[model samples]
Target: MPSLDTAKAYYEYFNQKNWDGMISLLHPEVRHEPNQGEPRIGLELFKAFMQHMDESYEETLTDMVFFTEPNDERVAVEFVVNGIYKKAEEGLPAAHNQKYVLPAAAFLGFTDGKISRITTYYNLPLWIKLVSE
Candidate 1:
């Protein structure tokens, strides 16, 4: 699949909460960079992070647009995140099923049809404020 297709598929998997499907598209040494944290390497760490996210929040991506490099090795995605904070995460405001909507973006790198890196960005303060309200 093309890089844009791969990114769309990943997001589709995420929207369905299909962790396995998402992971299947990733390289064994995939690097994941969260919004405002250190990068986490490896599929195992990614899986753990996904599990934590699943436990703490419920989210869906909407209004998505994907862009790809000429070589098709990189894909950039812009979307809106609609989410409900289900559980409290460390160093974050307490969750009480709070709903939030925010713009977000992700940059994905592909190698041999597998995603090698995923770096996501969003407004952390805005998200926190929305959920806290």
Candidate 2:
């Protein structure tokens, strides 16, 4: 099924920093749930969020393991985020290309040959500690 492939490609594009490629895999009405923020809706809104993420940080997902529902309607991926705080966005702290590695996961739903829902989870306090060091 395309679920696993699509999910893999999504992360691959992300690792490549191919923002447009990553966006291309999103459904038109995609909804994004961040680890510590309110839900974001629609492709355009997600695009804006991606733009902000791109500007604020650099990251790659590693050690990825994928799981799926029986009908492949949904997928979950667990991975490690190797990231650098390239710029300050949130009020967490000032950035100076600080590098950190943390565990993370994302749940995804598929629709119309693309991912329609993406919800991510990670440890905020751990990330803060890592970057603050």
Candidate 3:
């Protein structure tokens, strides 16, 4: 599969909460760059991050639009994260099932038909305000 297909599957699996499915599309030494954070490398670290995320939030990606370069080595996707804060995360408000809509995007890098890197972006303050209200 090309980078675009892998990216579509990644978000599909995420919305379905299929962590293993998401992992299957990743390279063994995948690098994850969360918005405003240090890059995390390797599948194991990715799994741990996913587990932590799963425990805290219930989210679905909506209004998705994907873009790619001619060589298909990279892909960028835009979407909205419709989510409910299920539990508390560090430096965030107490969770009372607060719902938030966050517009987000990701840049994907592929290696051998798998995603080797992912850098994601979203508005943190908007999320905080929406959920806090």
Candidate 4:
């Protein structure tokens, strides 16, 4: 499948909260980088991170647009995250079911039809301000 198509499918799985389906699309050695955190290597860590995210937040991506090069090895996605702070995360504002809508972007690398790396970007301060209100 095309890289953009794969990215779309990945987001679809994400929006559906299908962790297994999302994991199935990742390479065994996939690397994940959050907006303001260290890069995590391997699928196991990625799965753990997903679990943590599931426990802390309820979110969905909207207004997605994907960009790719001719080789289709890399894909970039721009979207908005519509989320509610469901549970308190460590070292952050208290969760009171606060709703937030933030613009975000992600760059993905593909290897042999599987996602090799994913790096996401967003405004953390803006998110904090919105949630802290």
Q: What's the ranking of the predictions by lDDT, best on top?
A: 4, 3, 1, 2
Of the candidates numbered 1 and 4, which has the greater lDDT value?
A: 4
Collision pairs in model 2: none
Structural similarity to truth (TM-score) of each candidate: 0.98, 0.96, 0.97, 0.98
lDDT tens per residue, model 1, 21-70: 99999999999989887999999999999999999999999999998879
Q: By summed lDDT, which 10 consecutive residues of candidate 1 come out lowest?
A: 1-10
Residue pairs with clashing backbones, model 1? none
lDDT, each prediction: 0.94, 0.93, 0.95, 0.95
Clashes of each: 0, 0, 0, 0
Candidate RMSDs in order: 0.7, 1.0, 0.7, 0.7
Task: Show where candidate 3 strays beyond 4 Å.
Answer: none
Model 3, residue 80: C-alpha shift (Å): 0.4
Which window of ten consecutive residues has the lowest lDDT sum in model 4? 1-10
Tens digit of per-residue lDDT, candidate 4, span 54-103: 99999999999999999989999999999999998788999999999999
lDDT of 3 by residue, 1-133 (tens): 8789899999999999999999999999999999977899999999999999999999999999999999999999999999999999778899999998899999999999999999999999988999999
What TM-score number comes out for model 2? 0.96
